[model samples]
Target: MGEPVRSLPHLVGRRLSRVVVLIAVILSGLLLGAGIEAQEADNSTANLPTDAESAVAARVQERLGTAEFTPAIVVFDRGGDALTDEDRDVVQRKLSELQELAAPGQQVFPVLAEDGQAAFVGVPISAETPEEELAEPVAALRDAAAEGLPEGLRAQVTGGPAFIVDLSQVFDGADVRLLAVTASVVALLLLLTYRSPWLWLVPLSVVGVADQVAVQVVAAATQVFGFSTDGASVGITSVLVFGAGTNYALLLIARYREELRLVEDRYDAMRRAVDRAAPAILASSGTVVLALLCLGLADNPTSRNIGFGGALGIATAVGYALLVLPAAMTCFGRGLFWPFVPRVGDADPTRSGLWARVGHAVTARPVVVAVAGTLVILVCAGPALGVKVGLSETEQFRAEPEAVTGQLVLAEHFPAGSSQPTTVIVATEDRDRVESGVARVQGVQRVESAGEGEGSAVLSVVLDAEPASADAFAVIEEIRAVAAQQSPGALVGGPDAEALDASDAAARDQLLIIPLILVVVTLVLLVLLRSVVAAAILVLTVVATYGASLGASWVAFRTFFDFPALDLSVPLLGFLFLVALGVDYNIFLITRAKEEAEEHETKEAIATALAVTGGVITSAGVLLAAVFTVLGVLPLITLTQIGVIVGFGVLLDTLLVRSVLVPALVTLLGRRFWWPGRLSHDGRHDGRHDGRQGSPAGHVAD
Candidate 1:
């Protein structure tokens, strides 16, 4: 029989009152944290970070110290187009008006280019000005320019803030739709799984708190550290914070219910539940935070910012789960599972019937189950090898009217790669020679001669492809080689080439970090479960699922999105989510499986564990997927990619990893499902065996 609940005296509610007091202190601290940042208007957009903007800022700072510069509209007209004296006078007056309108960093420098075909206008973006504050100024300038434009002349505003604002308008509604669809699917799954109002209500309730806490923490961090958040990071953080936080909460709650059957007192049961699940929760959260932390390897500030924000979110989730959850459970007591099918003082049905039958069948034919499950995984995985990660910010605005108009305007007047590229700046002992040398780079399709200063000149070379493309990087290398041979002193720096270098380095970093995380996670599993083989198997499964998910994403995006493939970050992000969340599920299932097997046969244990935990995980996965799907509706390519990839991964984890792969693998392993552990033979009854028979070789719990 199972050991008495009190037999493991050390594991009981030791210092329960103190733990409760600690939770109270934490909740108070979190509340105090909330008040640290005064509530403001719902300027949610302003809270979003802009890594691209940060990249541009870094470049500008390098070029011209930390001094401010205003974004301006450059007007162009055909040469020799005679302007009436009145029109010329009007233009002159408007220029002065714009100059007078300038404020600190918000100044305008209006200039008509010497060719008369183009004019440059500069407007300073104030250091203190938030994004929303610039709209009126931008609109006023556009209206002023449009009103002053002579017939057949066109004016274009190309500046940092203007572009970001335009892009934001395009992506406005995208995230909402995706969020709605994802939430619906998750709620449906939850309803099916628990069929309990309390279960559904708990996740939804905790998700709100999680979302608020993450955003507030992120914003506060950025403010304190003087760091900036990009638009892409904001949406991705929201989904991750919500999905992962809710998943952790579910793990704790589900474990609590399971432990309920084995213990008499409600508080005592919760204490056991916390002790059993806390280590797994801590380990899983660590893996996720570590994966995100690894993103700091990228030189890209965007990825770094995401890593910071994401790490913060995961940390917050862990703290909240450990402290807040237990307190809430204690406060609610039995009512926590009330108005639902409470398992209070009752035997769980998982030990017998359908669960038992399936368990018995699996043990009887482990090879068949394992082989069939492998076949299914292989089928799903075959299409995944072609997965691609290509992202374009323009795609996020496809559903927006303003974005459509802006994109059309841009396409008509600009090359597809006009928005970005590697610019090779040539400076040499002899500037004339540098220009001539830069002109010879093979892949460079166009070169504009800039700054004919004494003994100095700059060459702006535009390549044939997007600057971030690998082909573009190759071109940069060739150009650098040519420059070295000819004008060796030239500094080649631009978004494209820099991004390529950063991307390559990040790729290598991910390779190193993936294995590191695996090892660490595996170690955690080994220590917690006391089974080396089980930990290895779980880790291997998670890694395989990641690869398969990536492959499938490549196919989906390539065929349907008509985009290139996936982003450079897909692999790392996929691994992070898959491994961390995958392990979370593993802990829930394997721990329960071990509990059952310790008192019964391996098959019976597997069956009972599946019945008890399978439905909850499936529901959690659905909810998590739904949360990610909301990102697909976001008007940004980055968010959409994250949503699709993470959503795909969660579904795969649920249906494949949890439902079939794990069960099949365990069955095949059989008696060795636990290699260095022995089954309990005592007739002492834990609630699991109250109404059920142990396997033939074992005595049932009394």
Candidate 2:
């Protein structure tokens, strides 16, 4: 069947060769994955377009020869009670020590809030500090703030620099944690799917090794490419390797088990299984890789890097699954299945079960089933219309870190936007004019000259609203507009302005990349399934699945998680993952159904296809969903939101859309479902029970 494709699995068929490949794969994974530890773990970017105003504002300072320094806010609070004189004395005593932590060209200054209950020390740390060494200065400041502190007064090191440190810290041991959790989840699911204890180990170990190897590859790629990657991307990549890699394993092993029933020789069975299933596996991986690579067109640096890293990981996973995994499986004997071992004459257990009945039920009333499934998807998607986009800076964390709390405290006790003020850079000659214009703006509370260097001057404008709020963003827009009118080259930036630009960039990227990804995926489906009708149907179903999953997840986020708004990247990233991964089940099911159609009527073929592929796809889907859910282990809100959305999307796609709706559509379409393909008019069919009465005989669940 795979004559055009060389049986790469069998190349390692020699007893010694199989063992050699297996051992080599494991060692490579270990040594290479360990190398990731040497690569820096912090790769996060603001995820904004480089040409945006905020980005230009950031660069203006560098060009003006002023060192880039980010402030670390040292916040001290006395709860509802006003700060006592003793509390003020302690802050005074620590001010000199905190100044020691500031960057060489910067200094620290203590300022008491008007409310007298909170005070802050703004400590500037050089932005040029290497990512690995960023925490050292922040840590020293935090230690100084904590020791010899008087009772009833507490302090937290926060603001931009501290936020960066905390965010990176959240991923300190995330790889090991995610790997351990993902591996354990995979092992458990595999063991359950194949009742034999020994059977589960084969695919788990193979996929596990692939995930570790992917980590090393991703880390190395980051160094060579110098693209912005972060701990969250690293975590997501590992999850993808385990989830998608193990899925390939499940599909392969299921076919292998089925083939074992007809082919007595275990080695021969493995070869036949690889020959039949490899194409679908390859097609599935191709679509995902291509779709992920489309992220290269994204404006967000993190999005582009994620696409690159995820694509590399998927390629690595598929390579190992098709090559190393097959060799590893063949090294074992039939006894690997233990009491459930397949015999040449034994009944294929997958022909009947929850899936067989579902097939029967679907065939009985294709129109009704199709209508009902569409309604479910539509209902799930309703809430999406009201979904909000763009979480505030402090909202980026699921669990409030000291930075977030400090920002809140600062907001409560000080003037509006006291925690962080918007920065504006302009030509030194026009600084006074631009500053005067900005000061007269409706939202401007005050404008202070930061410094001047070369031919440029910097202004820190305190706005009349909390940082990153809608009001603050509005103020930034007004400030920018005024700057453009009074001083054309003035650049406005800082936390609030950067976030504003990021939101706009995310919107722009969505418009550009979404259609591009859809086109890529659609073209891939068109190639994989030769029938235009089938390809169109699969693409529509995947779209519906994405919409439904996003809508449903938005509801969950609001109702249970109480999230204010989705991160700017969530909707686009969620759509990308759902579309790419959702097509996997379509490829698996429809390809199998196509094969069955050669020998059976259309309705009967689809029913039979469902019974056979149901168990494996369902198992794989649930396992993948669970692995994604493990992202909840990290504290970042963006990652958590992604995990929930994608996880739920996978479940919805696997359990409903693939299992019922698509099959029903095909059943109703009859032979026309395969129109333009040989199966529509040619090939063999027994014409037994044309899908109205008896469904295909057999249970397909594992």
Candidate 3:
């Protein structure tokens, strides 16, 4: 008689109980460390500003008089032909009202600019100004501008601080909408896949717990480390944490159910499930974790933080999957696969009509199938060459009234490049000469000499394009070239040009990092699988999938959404995530295929692998896609980019790469795919029990 399924779980339970105690102890320490880190992280901001940012601030201080750029700007148009008596009166009153908004520690500067038609009253916010202090002052200023205005004139206000506050207030509602939609769709998909509410709870509950742990831990860590999130990146955190967590849970549960179907006693089923599934899940999670950690190599603070947070999430999911999942499965036992409980029978590969056809087609003309699949990938990759890279923050709220108003004001008064333009600072003993040199540079609309000292002079060079644009890079290089000839002694430094330069340099660095990380990661897989050829092909397939996904995202965003080219970092991130996590499905499917091949013939092997592993990978992919879709619904362009790119990327990985590409490629390659391994040369391996049983059955049994 077959070994009782209960026996598997009993074995697991005996071993796991001991490990659980040790885990509890380690978890306690991590929790305490996290608590301490949380406090430290919260205060971390105080310790930072040491490097380039601080240097930039010091340079700006010379001409700006220590009055840093107030993130708040004031706008009130004067009556026609400059301010009339009435306009003057209104402006004075508005200024008076704005004074009341100034908190004890805050500073607000009132200024005026008049064109032929009207005048705009403005304010520059200080660096350390608090939102609470700015809100009331800004609101009062707006009210004053609104009152006593000339008939044709109107008053409006906009600024980064205000935008953040506005987005924050509305984000709660947006998040609510996002969560409701995500939960509904996900629940529907799960129910459809499982056909049982009882089994569906496993993934839902697991993902929910994992989400809490990831978010809370990341929040607590950032707070302790003193990392503050940008408004857009803040929204992204939710989608990433939940989406990845759910993907992990679905894979684990699917494997558990599949194992339970074959092993009768519930306990043994869970143990076998853990043994069979955990390795692939862990492998996938490990690759992702390592890739994210690679983000630490970035010079940009934003990229660095994202990398840290992402790595943390991947790591947490790995831990939960290996430990908590086992514990929970042990508790549920046979009931875990309830409503469609396994009948202690082998899976029948030919049971599904769909599988029968796919199996026949795959083996019938493997070359034709492989060539056709390759053609599809090459065709989809065409748009990738047209991809561009840049971001417009205002695009986040293209439909919002405030964003529209803000854009109008900026276009009318400010330089088109005013949104964080690249400032080229040429410091020299001859300040006046350096300023003249900067002004002469092509594309430089204006140059302001800042600071007064014996050794230094800071010149702010405003370019004609947004700082993140390719044009801006050209402008910066022009300024540098001109300044080098004119001011041989000047030190050039500013946030605008420096940030762009750093980002470009970082992108180059990632190119090298990708291959290095890939080799290291693939090596790990190689050791685990003990097959060099399998490792090489797996990496190659994942790369193809990533490229296809990126190309598709470029078209979707650029053509459909009318977004600018994909984010510069998207390719790097896409490579890391798809390559790492994408390989998980490969490991799951291929390993199973190998086991089947050991016992059954090649045709039967491919059929059996798909029957057992396909459903689980598909479910996992959908869950991941649902979670990522939350990013698309957010009101920020950055998150939206991340959402669509990753969501589509995962889909491509599952539907195309995992489902067709890898399987077809493996079938075409056949035994050659596992070269140098003992299994490849010999027709036997101990892992396959089918051979001993004479291949009596070669199909999934429901």
TM-score of each: 0.76, 0.94, 0.83
Which regions of candidate 1 deviate over 4 angstroms? 1-137, 141-161, 167-193, 196-199, 219-228, 259-264, 333-345, 352-361, 392-422, 426-428, 443-449, 452-457, 463-471, 673-702
Runs off by more than 4 Å, candidate 2: 1-9, 12-23, 26-44, 682-702
Q: Report the error of model 1 at residue 140, Å.
A: 3.6
The better-scoring model by TM-score among 1 and 3 is: 3
Predictions in order: lDDT = 0.60, 0.83, 0.61
Best by TM-score: 2
Q: lDDT tens string, model 3, 114-215? A: 353334444555545555455565566566657766686677666555554555544556645765666666677778877876766756655555555666
Cα error of candidate 3 at position 627, Å: 1.5
If the candidates were sorted by their lDDT against the true structure, best first, what order would they fall in? 2, 3, 1
